[model samples]
Target: QASLADLDILRRTRRMEYFRIVNWDNMLYPQYEDKMQKTIAPDIWKWLQSEAKRKLAEKPVAHPAVRAHWQSIVDGIVPFGYNVVEE
Candidate 1:
């Protein structure tokens, strides 16, 4: 069956992981080569920044399932130098 639901998984998953990690900077990836006076389409990078901020603002502290998923994200981001809040 064809559906729009299954579509964009690649983009969605990619953005999800990117959001979990708060290191959105051109110094990190070449995706952002221009800024200020000039720029290109900022879809993925923008999605990450906006989505990350929107989510973390809620501070989801309930739901073990959500926590477990966030745990994996935290572990994955460890190499990037961002610390996760533990309680």
Candidate 2:
């Protein structure tokens, strides 16, 4: 069973990974430029900046199953189970 401390560490690691993935200044796919210009060009940069700031300030929320499992472990009960299924 993972302790709360362990879960917190994992959460921080995931947050760092997320930040790394989204930390790009520009979109990589130039092929999508035309579509982006039509749909998002006007406010895309402003929206991105606001979202980055908001996400940076936001706290990560654990999944309900994960939280239940943690609590169950703490209470010495049959802990909830989950799988990290990646496609």
Candidate 3:
């Protein structure tokens, strides 16, 4: 059986490899962003923005500073599977 440290190293290595494979074109190709941008319809993009804003509005924080900070945290989240990426 692998040791804890060995398993941890393997997990990190595999994660790196997975992202490298998935984002290879985005990393190497300059037109990747342009192509991706073109694929998102304007109406869909607008709807997404509106939905995000509505979701944020639903969770109201009383203080201005707290609200701003909370919004920043919410905006940074990317949903993956059943959970958002912690980082």
Best by TM-score: 3
lDDT of 2 by residue, 8-84 (tens): 67678766322112323345777655333312232433444454445444624756665554445334342223222
lDDT of 3 by residue, 1-87 (tens): 456566567668776321111345675777776433323334444444465566568857557765665455457432222222122
Worst 10 residues of 1 by lDDT: 33-42
lDDT per residue as tens, model 1, 4-84: 334456448655443222235655666554322122234543444454445555667657665554555443433134333
Q: What's model 1's overall lDDT? A: 0.43
Judging by TM-score, tell me the better candidate of 2 and 3. 3
What do the candidate models score in CA lDDT, each in turn? 0.43, 0.42, 0.48
Give TM per candidate. Answer: 0.26, 0.23, 0.29
TM-score result, candidate 3: 0.29
Candidate 1 vs 3: which has more lDDT: 3
Instruction: Rate residue 63 of model 2 by lDDT.
Output: 68
Model 2 score (lDDT): 0.42
Q: List the residue pairs that clash in candidate 3.
A: none
Once model 1 is optimally superposed onto the true structure by TM-score, how far is the C-alpha of residue 34 displaced, in angstroms?
Answer: 20
Task: Count clashing residue pairs in model 2.
Answer: 0
Instruction: Give the Å shift of residue 10 in candidate 1.
Output: 9.6
